[model samples]
Target: MPRFAANLSMLYPQHDFLDRFAAAAADGFEAVEYLFPYDYSTQELRARLSDNGLVQALFNAPPGDWAAGERGIASLPGREAEFRDGIHQALEYAAVLGNDRIHVMAGLLPDEALRGKHQAVYQENLAFAAAEAAKAGITVLIEPINTRDMPGFFLNRQDQAHAIREAVGASNLKVQFDFYHCQIVEGDVSTTLRRDFANVGHIQIASVPERHEPNLGELNYANLFNLIDSLGYSGWVGCEYRPKGDTHEGLAWLRQWKAQQA
Candidate 1:
């Protein structure tokens, strides 16, 4: 069965970031992932994970100047040095956190005219990051964020992500298959999973349109989970969603799923 990892960034917002580790454990999550871990010291983060008996499953590399609207620097030409530096920083944390994958965000593209140029830059940067991460036994991930959620995002389709991974030509370069975004971008989630399972290194989920709990979505997660298990996708499925109500209260679906699995 696919193991579930609470997305601490979205799921445990009621508590402070550090305290959310315990909250996730209390909620019966065996693993957790967040957007970034730069805010806390590696020792502190590691200690929290160890204490909570949770594994750090995934996280993103620094998206430059997030508040200023720089989602990522990897595909931005002339920001090569900054992107490389971000990779080094991410690896430093991964070493201590013991996580194996890092999602390299592709920032928004203001000019569609520069698509080819930006794509080349993205591929090159991914290759470089993959080389560095491979040294630390880490995999570099690229995700296809839906345009509706993130208009003009650089990477926005599964085929695009797969092509980039091929162009990068690195064993460690993989796709972070997010069901929420995939459903928004392309309708057939199950087929896509089977078709690209080889390229997929990790998976994430949230309901379509509202981005809530999996059970509340139009997509049948229970069946999808069965498909995932049958397909032998032995990777973490990140619960990356906004709670429709109280976080714990919104987990009735999870409780039921766990009961079924048990």
Candidate 2:
């Protein structure tokens, strides 16, 4: 069975951020992930993880000015320095939290005409991040987000993400395959997973269209989970979805999956 990591950023919205760690643990999640850990001291965050016996499965590198609506600066031409600084900061936090993987968000591209410029900057920035992370024994992940949810997200397709990873040629650089996004951008999720399985570094899931519990969506997560096991994927599968009702109440799918596995 694939290990599931509760995405605290989306799950358990009822509790304070710090409190969510324990809530996830009590609900049977062995690991947790969130959007940004920069706001809290590493000691505070680490303590929460240790106290709850939850592993820090993943977290994103700082995206520039999230409050100002800048998702990420990695692919932006003039923000290379800021992007690099963010990568360093993320690495520092990862070390303290004992996380081995970090996701790099590719910022929005408002103008399609400037895609060439953005792609060049993105490739260079990723290469730099991968090299730095490699020295720390960490894997750098790039995810292809759906344009509908993130209208101007630079990376939106599985093939595009893998191509950029190949072009960058960093052995430690890999793709963060999110099934929710993949289903939105391209319908053939299973085939894409199999085709890109080797290059994948991480996995995430949510219901399609509504972005709720995996079992509520158009996709058959049970079969997909089985397929993932068959493919020999031994990585954390992030439950990156918003709950339709009470978070704990919405965890029936998880309990069912675990029971089926047993």
Q: Which candidate is the best by lDDT?
A: 2
lDDT of 2: 0.95
What local lDDT does model 2 show for residue 43? Answer: 100
- What are the lDDT scores of the predictions, listed in order? 0.92, 0.95
How well does each candidate superpose onto the true structure, as a TM-score? Answer: 0.98, 0.99
lDDT of 1 by residue, 1-262 (tens): 7799999999967888899899889989999999999988999999999999999999999999988878898999999999999999999999999999999999989899999999989988998999999999899999999988888899888988999899889999999889999999998999998999998999999998899999986999989999999989888999999999888889999999889888
Task: Give the C-alpha lDDT of model 1.
Answer: 0.92
- Roughly what TM-score does model 2 have, to 2 decimal places? 0.99
Q: Compared to the true structure, candidate 1 yields what TM-score?
A: 0.98
Off by over 4 Å in 1: none
